[model samples]
Target chain A: MRLAQLSERSGVSAATIKYYLREGLLPPGRQVNATTAEYDEEHLRRLRLVRAMIQVGRIPVATVREVLGHVDDDSLGRTIRVGAALWALPQVPEPDEDDAYVRAAHREADALLDTLGWENARQLTTISPAYRRLVVALAAFRRLGYDWDAELLVTRARLMHQAAVADLDFLETQPSEEEKVEAAVASAVLVEPMLQALHRLAQEEESARRYGFE
Target chain B: MRLAQLSERSGVSAATIKYYLREGLLPPGRQVNATTAEYDEEHLRRLRLVRAMIQVGRIPVATVREVLGHVDDDSLGRTIRVGAALWALPQVPEPDEDDAYVRAAHREADALLDTLGWENARQLTTISPAYRRLVVALAAFRRLGYDWDAELLVTRARLMHQAAVADLDFLETQPSEEEKVEAAVASAVLVEPMLQALHRLAQEEESARRYGFE
Candidate 1:
């Protein structure tokens, strides 16, 4: 298919597609002649994935490019590939290390992970900023006199893990490593808003039940 | 306490606290004299809350001001106040209204809510943009041929609702409406990173278990 057909089929503007090509977010189509190129099914698939990453996942283009590089590279280990994809998603910035609260929060996080007996807890260091921020947030909640229970956090993690396992089961079935990587990354990044929306809805329900807020 | 003491106690820089004051995110301190003011514990508390909203919650200053306005206003209904706080939290941008996919996703969202028998589902329209974006993201997942089950979503929601209930239980005990609003908003915003971090950690655990990775 030509660029116009690809644009028509994918519902992406030709100019945006051209921009993606220029940014190397979408690989260039086969050169047919001067000022013309042919896009195949692969290009269409990639275009859709790119759209999902940008439009739904809200991943930055540079991060998407890096993530896609991992997706296309076969030599990288699966753990690193998956980690790269997860890292591409947005997260909270880490607090300054010198801050007393941040230091305490990191200790709290380590203790919580230890108490939960999560294997390879130190792998959290890879996403340390987000993890550290979580700890800081939890500590802030505690200072406000809220009980952010360690047990409760573990329970929530377990439930989310169950949901993820189902998603990963499907992901594991993709026909190729590349497809699997794409699907896994897409699932990790795009599914977040769904989870968040459901959480808000659930909060509404809980609020109604607790406060008679109908 | 003076501004310096408030800054020292809160661990926020005096300049930033002054900025918050200038921005009206923090209420002005009591005027003592020209170029002099006195802040009390209320000011200190508000300063901490403002910092939490900005640093940990990642809420924009404008939204923080708006949310704090809701917090300070005594005449606003509880539901509206809580809604404002929730609204102040970051959310995904809604998809285009005219897009067929987004329309379908909205329909899907409505149906899912109906199936769950959630009360006052129409209130979703107030925050429809974020909700619609979530539905659109879910639809994108389905388009990718992943079975993102409604039942699965509900289960996740139930689990999250449980976590929320635990948090809200603490919120319910606040002695004043202002305190309740502050706690509710802080929990709504700051807890998100904690949840996301735990989700990622859970993903790591699940990945390790399923794929036999370290």
Candidate 2:
């Protein structure tokens, strides 16, 4: 198929496709002649993935490239690949003041995982700097007068863990290596919005139930 | 107290507080003399809230202003105030192609809520445009070859609804109208990062448990 058909089938404009090609987001199609190129099913698959990352996942092109690079590398383990995808996400900056509050939060995060018997919780910070930033952010919640201690964080983590288990169960069934990697990356990137939307919906329902807002 | 005291108490810099005053994110303090101004506890509280919205919540300054505007309006109902806060966050753009795929996802979102017996589920879109964008995003999941339908969505929503109930339980105790509004807005804005971080931590733990990677 030519670039035209790829654009038509993918619903991406030809010019944008060319832009992707130029940016190395999309691999160059096979040279058919001086002015034409052929794209195959692989290109179509890659195009869809790229579009999903940018358009749906809202990831920047550079981050998308980095994430895809990790996915394309077979030598990297699956865990590392997942970490890479997650690392590409925007993260909250850690508080500049390493105050007692920040240190307490870190301890609480570790202790929460310890109490839950989650053996790998402490290792999370080492995997991604975002995890440490997350801990700091959680501590900042206390400053807002919300008593979001380790107990509350763990309870919420446990619930979301169940959902993650369900999501990963589906990922385990993908037949191809490439499919599995793409699924993992998509799960990491896409599930955040899905869960957040669900969170807001739940908040609305809860608010109505509590406040009698019809 | 004055601007320096307000900064000292809130841990925000004088320059940033001045910027907030300039941006109208914080109200101007009362005039004390020709060159000095007096700020009270209200100023301190507003400064902290604005800092939380920008630094921790990662909300854009414009949206923060809009959300604070709604909060400042005493006549608005609690539901509307909550909606305003939800609206202020960054949202995913809805899929442009209103194809069968997009429509199917919408039906799936509705069906998921229906099956869950959640009465206020449809009201989510009315509350926040993010919900509609979320539905379209779920459709894009299928494009990535993940079989996420209404069933999976509801299951996740149910889990998060439980968490939301837990979060809102604390709001019941605030005695003053201002406290309630600030708590509601804080919950709506700050909880996303907290939940997202928990999600990531849970994912890491789950991945390690399944893959045996330390």
Candidate 3:
């Protein structure tokens, strides 16, 4: 196929595809002749993955390049190689160290990990956007005078971990490494808003029962 | 309390507080004199709620006012009024109707709710940001060539619903309507990124085990 077909098939514009090829986010297709290039199935597949990261995951192009590079690297184990893409995803700003609420929230986040017995996961905690987000949310709760109790936070996390396990099982069911990596990112970027939405719907259910609107 | 006192205690600058007052997001303080007005605890609480909606919830001021108005309306039952705020949150663009994939995804989303037995919650699904987000995500998966089996989507949604129930339980524990509404928005907006972060961390744990790194 050519650039025109790639754009038509992938739903990405020909010009944007050109930009990606120039930036090395997508490898160059085979040069058929002067002023013409041919793309293989691999190129088509790679184009889709790139679009997923940008469109669904909302990762920056620079970060997407790094993530794809990490995915392509063979030095690491297959799981770690693909998981590296996650480490490269954007992270949150560190909360102020001097703020007492932040300090307490940090301690609570650590303790919640301990309670969940996520020892190995904890090793990645310090580097994870998830951990920072939790700490930040906990602190924000306190700042707003709602002191999210430690017990409640832990309970919520346990449920989240269960969901994560289910997600991993589904990702493992994918047949290819490329698909697996795409699925992992897809699940992460896509399932997030879905979870939030389901939450609101569930809340509506709970609220109906509690207030007798059902 | 004076504006400075309110600022000092609330940690919002006086200028910002004045802006909130001028915007009618905050109720006017008691008029002690032409030079000074005294604010009560209610003003402080309302100010905090407004800030939560703006800074944490990222809701535009106009929308925030509408949400707060719904929250304050007495005719609606407690759960319905508070939950109304969620319906006002930002939603995703509706997927193209003529797209076969989108039409398929819409039916699947409907079935997902049916499978979960979320009968009452389904009423609010069309109006909810969560529903649109899920539909868009499901359609994207198809557009990208991932089938996202009906069983799998429903399974993922069940886990999400459980977590949501827990969230609603937590919200119910709050002591007042203002606090309840603020906590509802806080949980939705703040916990979202936290959930995404957790999913990534969980994937790490799963990858370690699957690849024999653990």
Best by DockQ: 3
Off by more than 4 A, model 2 = A1-4, A18-41, A88-102, A139-148, B18-42, B60-62, B88-102, B142-147
Model 2, docking class: medium
lDDT of 3: 0.75
DockQ, cand. 3 = 0.54
Q: Judged by DockQ cut-offs, is candidate 1 incorrect, acceptable, medium or high?
A: acceptable
Model 1: interface root-mean-square deviation in Å: 3.2
Which stretches of model 1 miss by more than 4 angstroms?
A27-40, A88-95, A123-152, B28-40, B88-95, B126-130, B136-152
Proportion of native contacts in model 3?
A: 0.54
* lDDT for position A55 in model 1: 76
lDDT value, residue B111 of candidate 3: 84
Q: Candidates 1 and 2: which is better by DockQ?
A: 2
lDDT per residue for candidate 1 within B95-201, as digits (tens), equals 66786666777777777777767665455555644465567676676554455556656666666667767767777777887888777777667666677777777
lDDT of 2 at B111: 76
In candidate 1 chain A, where is summed lDDT lowest over 10 consecutive residues? A121-130
List all candidate RMSDs to the true structure.
3.6, 3.5, 2.6
In order, the Cα lDDT scores of the candidates are 0.71, 0.75, 0.75
Q: Of 1 and 2, which scores higher on lDDT?
A: 2
